[model samples]
Target chain A: MKKLYSTKYFKNKNNKHAEASLKKRLRFKKNKKKRNKIQNARTKPQKRVVNNKNKHFDYFKSKAPGNFSFLTHPIEVIEFISTLKSHFDKKRKVFILMNKIKSIDYSAIVILLSIMVKFKEKKVEFNGDFPSDDNINNILIASGFFQTLFKISFKTRERYNIGTHNAIHTHAWKDVDAELGANIMDNVSKMILGHKVIYKGLQRSLVELMQNSFNHATPTKEGEKHWWLSVNVNEKQKIASFSFIDYGVGIFESLNSKKEGSKFFNWKILMNLFSSENNADVLRKILNGDLHKTVTGKHYRGKGLPGIKEAMDRNLISNLHIITNNVFANVGLDKYELLPNNFEGTFVYFEINAQTSSTPWTELQ
Target chain B: MDRITVKIARDFSRTPGPRYIKEGKWSGEQFRTEKFYSIFDDAIKNDKIVVVDLDGTLGYGTSFLEEIFGGLIREHHLDYNQILNHLELISNEEPYLMTDIFAYLKDAHEESLVDNH
Candidate 1:
């Protein structure tokens, strides 16, 4: 019975062999696909580091004085400036490349301004081709350098047409050039020496204010923070103005969120918060007759405003104006005063005395 | 029998500033204050040797420290020897030691004068 049951052992063996072959073919196909993927990856060309080096060297060589180039990173701009300083014999003829500059932090501005100031001190002929936009120009003016270095004048209707488009414009032996890739090496060299001390105090103050904007006012989501800063030097008055502006949530909104009562919304309450000893440590310090010591902690502790006040007092700057939420505060030699303005957001404007013939570094111990 | 009891208001060893603590080890300020106060309270309650070492633990302003310690000394009626003994154990600086000693002594002296009146 066993011998005669099916009578097809060879056929069954062939079927099993066929199935094994099919499985082997599938495994081979999968392995071949993986191998091809790895080979493709191996053959992919990486960007050559030597090509970048050549491009970087070529960039400085081709840079023109007082012209702007398409540089996104601050490090690149700084490197380009270093190259220019090494190559150029005349330090004064160099101008900044700022037209394509999309964003700048306080530290960068401080470094750039320090370079400009050093160039002027060395009797170098320097001019900057800043963005022609009013906001941009004003920012530069406010940065405390615009008034200290360059003589600014509005172009008349006829001269405006020619000067606006031209890469270089001359007025009274002063040449304001376009944003050409220029040799900023001399400026960069001088700046590297002086920028550290100058920027420390400046950045500390700006960072405090900027942090206030970030934490209190326009609270930005993880990646949505937007702000602008500009600096300009006035050659005639020997004054410099640094200005910063942000489009985030304003001071009023911040205060309003933390407010408990209707009375807290008033301007007087806001002013008191800015200049009061309400917190426990601050109150204790005030009671202990330590007005100069700033109260600091996790929720709120900043010597920032106090530091700014100290800096202003030390410098003996004549004009200090703080504008926010359509209210303007002016602190002068004689008195403190306030005025209303249509402009919104916070604006801090100070006239840095250029004729004093002293840089911030000179005052630092 | 005279027992020298020092009631410390805060644990000098445990309390750390905001900058010192990582987020994973983040203990809130309230928790830190409680730990400090509890350690000090326990030290004071026990009739053991109480040591107040403000070597690196003085994170808050001098006034805050004064308010806290001033109130503690007044409440406990801590003697000059007790305060000095604590100071000697902590640091040998004159200005800080003298200032704190004078503050406590001045208050004690003033209270004595008021009692006399």
Candidate 2:
């Protein structure tokens, strides 16, 4: 034979076994180091990079949609705000791109202000650019967003003659300010009614709202968190729109944690048996005085919501809408909708127009 | 029986605030301690009917109303029936507030009964 492992290698069975052993030895000799490297890699632990630079390395960038409004684009606006929760939680820098925003409504403006206030509270770093569109930028300035956030004052631009133009007045308080609330009501009354008239229902509603915020807005005892209020008077439409916001554990969350195993809990169970216990349904029951009736032992508690509802019923205010947690309710129309995103706070918006009645200043004292 | 009148807007606050004094200025608790309670005590001792004028204020919050009326029974331990007998609430601007005050008194009385038992 020419060689032991030649073309006739398979011709002899004994020779073939010897050839197979030789081939195995040659293959193991060629790749022996590669096998050792893989084994060593499996047993070694990787090092973690703990540089301070790496802590702030990653940024969560969020883009604003064109119509950022709870009234116009509710789902998108809510979802956009929800994205910042992570930025707050991780204490990461967030870059919000607002170049694409065409228009923003008062509701969205209030929400954005509220979010920035929270970001300041948490010491979370966030950055944003003004909308390239000058009109939208003017709106941001006029609504006091830029002044409140960056402390940069711009020459107040001529207001847009849009539907229901806003002359925005904003306020923030840590405790109940009945005087401030009354002053606001007085100003709003003069703006709409052309005279000073105390709207009793509206004043009561404001006090109740402030009390709720002071008492239940936070998990802390009381007065630790600030409640924000914005009033936008539209002299053209003769409608004064008010927005009240508090960043707290929302209504449902507050009740659930605070009233565990109480009569409110029993009522909640009964409510669940009768209907789906979605946030909207629970909110409807609360507004309807169903849940309030269950907590009668305290007697002073649980009247804020129903009292607001009663004000609406008596035609003291119109277009009463509330968004808290994951529910959006148009209480005036009896429409309670379950939103896909959570608001993380309570927002109450109502309007008082020319037709809205008031207690004349002359009628009292 | 003798009669006395306490106009809340005149004697207490024209802008009544929240429930407790710790909550804010001009709170119902402050009003009760500084103004209303003394007058009420005198009325009870002297067999006088107390008339409370509930108007001429910016408005009355539920907590303010509750703390004043309900607190008579809850805080001071005054009999609710006697309070109802002697107390006269005049709310001309907001008539429904009178109804609400009466209800709060009844609720506080019921709550006190449960607590005692």
Candidate 3:
């Protein structure tokens, strides 16, 4: 009976299966050929406008240099850096064109710091020129990137004031086209290549912390707009630093309403609420479920600090020091060291490793 | 021998949504709760290769994972170091696990694979 079945049903079934497989294979082959043609067509030189209207709008819309306009939000900043990564081929000179920028906010500055750090980590050369103005310089200084992140010469400042500012003031800016158009790409290329990935995690953490300030700490007036930022990178040392500052109402005033009736509104209580292990764990538990709900209601998802703690544990980041409302929490060696300090709003600094040569943790361990 | 696979499970049920008050009382919608873990557990039992994409599967908080994976690890009596090593391996490949509890599941899966081997 088995032999008879095999001779009759099995042979017919096998033939049918073979025919179906052959048809499927032929279809796949045709699709593969079409796909190849499409892919090759994509590689052909395509006419792309170097200066489209939308690109022009993007160029003039905001301040800062490079693609800082891409750093409006923290998530956007992260996505931008992740995408910019593909541009780092490590062969050709990479340029971050920031000539069209006018001014920048602190949030944009911190995002820039993260990008610089990531670039340094990848060992890719970064080159760019940004507006050299007093306000821009002051914003950079306040964000903690003036001396810590980049080297700016006083002569360059004087030149900018005399050449750029005076040019705008006296309508002579158009006269020094040669000076303005000097080979900045080379200097930028060298600077970015030599740039170190320092204070990247700190910058990211500070951005988040500062945004939290805007969200829950600072009070917004009818039409008042404020910005905050920081950036630093040390490619060789694999260290980075970042900080942010906002001009809005500080933490004390923001939490003053809660302080009016509760004992948990004092600086010490606030610090504990922000850094205590129990509170952090509880917040972590709540955040583990759903972020949207945790962020929307009064039951605030207080996991930012805890998330920072977890990041420190997982990443190459070494330390996180936060100073808010005269209270401080310094996390190092997987422990929290609380201290009293005199400061306003929020300030955070952290250290991270940024060596492209080193094996990633997953691959190494 | 079947290739070892890791699976991730989420509890979308406990994920709170916009709250509503029915008759001036707080109530929740028919949110997906047990389906995530049930799918994962069923997949594991059936011995189908599983690779839990943490970022794709879970987001935000990880308490649900702490309970699920933590319980699995405890039940299996997996070596802590070995579990962590496996977790580090998966996390390095997919950093999303660093923010979610899927890392714990990866760790548990490694231990189970070692035991089976």
Candidate 4:
């Protein structure tokens, strides 16, 4: 009877001890899991993608500066590209935050619009913010930024021509064909310049410009090579100015690449030439067709620049200025000056004065 | 002397704007220059006069003109004057085109003689 009572008491005591030990082990496991999760959260790289598949892109994070009036602040244009490229490396849905833009200019609007087109070309989903400043917004819209975004046709109250909307807007080109070139020229002549005639040489020069972009722009992807063209008309001033921008390998760099491709020059000796002449001087030679004798070895080479010069010389275009790389060439003044910072590609701006032309737009068909 | 006329619109390309050679389209570097050269070369071999009509077509590119007119000198080894003698250019719509082609041919002649290659 005594042995049975003692065995029951010990069994009850053992069961209580076993239960406490099981709870202690479960508590330790829970604490370890919590610690592991907190440590993982601390060490892990922030998720680039969110649930909505949209990535948060900060403008200033890449440390690249945005440009305003890219002509005056050319380096900022390049810097802006660098920033955009860094974000592009992520390859997620990009939300371009332009609210951090420290400076803004009309030319900058053209460049941003071109980038947007690039994103569209790649099928990369993206949207951007307008500057918080009301003045900048007004300037961009007045300069035809939104109209271009919507792909508004180029015409006016005068002509109901399909694809002819009377506005200063951004445009892109791929080939040197007549359909695009002729239509663009007609719009510039009738709607902008108030001329009834399309200047054939000027139209041809535009094609050549696109050709240069194709031949030398040298983008990462072949189709990614794009040129941005904006034509603004000042009717009261009787002047029209055209801006063309291409983001690609610059002229000098392209010449160097071509030289290397042809195996024409010994880099050891050519390195000395780089020290002596800056890109601006090289640009002058290209415009004058002198680069043909030195580098390209082909007669047809350098013909495009001369073609554009011919248009300028013939009074079809006037007061021409080309900024490419770190060089600026003012053909009218016969001046070539090196800029403070380099532009990775090309920016060409020129004015057409109505009074300078002996040929009346009305007389042209 | 049979005066052969190559109407760009009817014979070569109605909208010869692009210059893609590999695609075999009506580009300057593709159909236009190649066909124009063949006809001109054939006409010249038989001592026939050649007339090129530049109307009824979407204009021309500098490369197109240079390749056809200047290519005679650079690629075929014909002198600039010889091509001008054999081939006559007529453009009612763009009268200055003939002169421009002549200048391009002359420039190509002077540049090709240098033997830069």
- Fnat for the candidates in order: 0.00, 0.70, 0.00, 0.14
**Residue clash pairs of candidate 4:** A153-A165, A154-A163, A154-A164, A154-A165, A155-A164, A155-A165, A155-A166, A196-A361
Please report the TM-score between candidate 3 and the true structure.
0.31
User: Largest lDDT belongs to which candidate?
Assistant: 2
Model 2: per-residue Cα lDDT over A1-365, one tens digit each: 65654655455776778799999988997688786665556522211112222343565677877888776677887788778877787787776778789887778777777677667656666656667688888767777776656643322211111122236766777888888767677778888888998887777788889898888888557887778777788777888888888888888877766655465565565554455467788788788787665454343233687888888888887899998988999888898998877877788888888888788785434
TM values, all candidates: 0.31, 0.81, 0.31, 0.67
lDDT of 3 by residue, A1-365 (tens): 66866786889998999999999999999999998776566522221223222244322122233334322233333344434544654333344544455655534554454444434444555444434455665555444443423433222111111112201110011011112111221222223345322222232243234334434444443113222333334335534443443333444455454434442345334343445354223323322323223333222222345545554655634555544443444555333322232333444455444432111111111
Off by over 4 Å in 2: A1-59, A152-166, A259-267, A270-272, A295-302, A363-365
Query: Residue by residue across B1-117, what tens digits does model 3's lDDT show?
Result: 133333331323212111111101111111212333343344455544334433222122232344345444545444444344333214443355454454455545564666578
| Candidate 2 DockQ, CA atoms | 0.40
Candidate 4 all-Cα RMSD:
11.2
* lDDT (tens digit, per residue) of candidate 4 on A215-315: 67883334346677776666677666677788888877665565444533453244346677767776777677666545444443325777677667767
Task: Give the interface RMSD of candidate 1.
Answer: 17.6
What's the best-to-worst order under TM-score? 2, 4, 3, 1
Clashes found in each candidate (C-alpha, N, C closer than 3 A): 40, 0, 25, 8
Q: Per-residue lDDT tens digits of candidate 4, residues B15-96?
A: 4554455312456666535687777778878888789877655445566666667677777777666677788787876676
DockQ of all predictions against the true structure, Cα-based: 0.01, 0.40, 0.01, 0.14
Q: State each model's CA lDDT, in order.
A: 0.37, 0.76, 0.38, 0.62
Candidate closer to the true structure by TM-score (higher is better), 3 or 4: 4
Locate the minimum summed-lDDT window of 10 residues in model 3 chain A. Answer: A166-175
